[model samples]
Target: MIYRNKTEAYWEPLLTIARDELGIHSFDPMGKPSADIRMCRVEDIGRALERAYDLGLMVGHTVTRAGCVNGECA
Candidate 1:
């Protein structure tokens, strides 16, 4: 599923990778995991999420004018 919302768009890929590649079925975003996913770095995921947020902001600006850009101007 293609998620357009910022949170899901950012996390869904990482969650999928955690489940498929790492064989982790008990992953929960709200709770701590019992085991870490192999070869995954917290810093890397954070950077990716930031990038996703930026991309989503750009797309949202291009599609609609619902909110002020960067809270600078309405």
Candidate 2:
């Protein structure tokens, strides 16, 4: 429910997907892949986005971005 900033709230879900589904533990801006990583399918992206929406984590959402405790982003 608490995020460091708007960016964090937005990126949390994607990062979770990267970690949980891809087994990616860390990242580097200019780093190259060191192993053969499994790619996420369209379905995976859809589900993660949906989960973020259901949790009200998107921009304009009151759950995290706007700091509203009782309203949803519409």
Candidate 3:
């Protein structure tokens, strides 16, 4: 999810990432109340993070073990 910020300069790069990298063909602001956050699916989260990092954006993900559930370990 792209968090909304006051920097309008980031908008173009964000859109480019969403379209070219994230495979989002189109954007519809009317479909939602706010256009702040944009959520999309990418084939690989690691690749997405790399792309975002290259664009000077910081993206992070957390991994848990298979036996872990809701922060608890079996």
TM-score of each: 0.37, 0.40, 0.39
CA error at residue 66 for candidate 3, angstroms? 46
- Model 1 segments more than 4 A misplaced: 1-37, 65-74
lDDT of 1 by residue, 17-56 (tens): 4455445453444343433334656766566566656767
Q: Which ten residues in a row have the lowest lDDT in candidate 2?
A: 27-36
Off by over 4 Å in 3: 1-7, 25-42, 57-74
Full-model lDDT, candidate 3: 0.56
- For candidate 1, list the clashing residue pairs, or say none: none
Q: Which 10 successive residues of model 3 have the least lDDT summed?
A: 58-67
Residues 17-71, model 3: lDDT tens digits = 6667766544544456665355665565456666767666332222244336465
Better of 1 and 3 by TM-score: 3
**Model 3 residue 46 CA deviation in Å:** 3.0
- Residue 42 C-alpha lDDT in model 3: 54
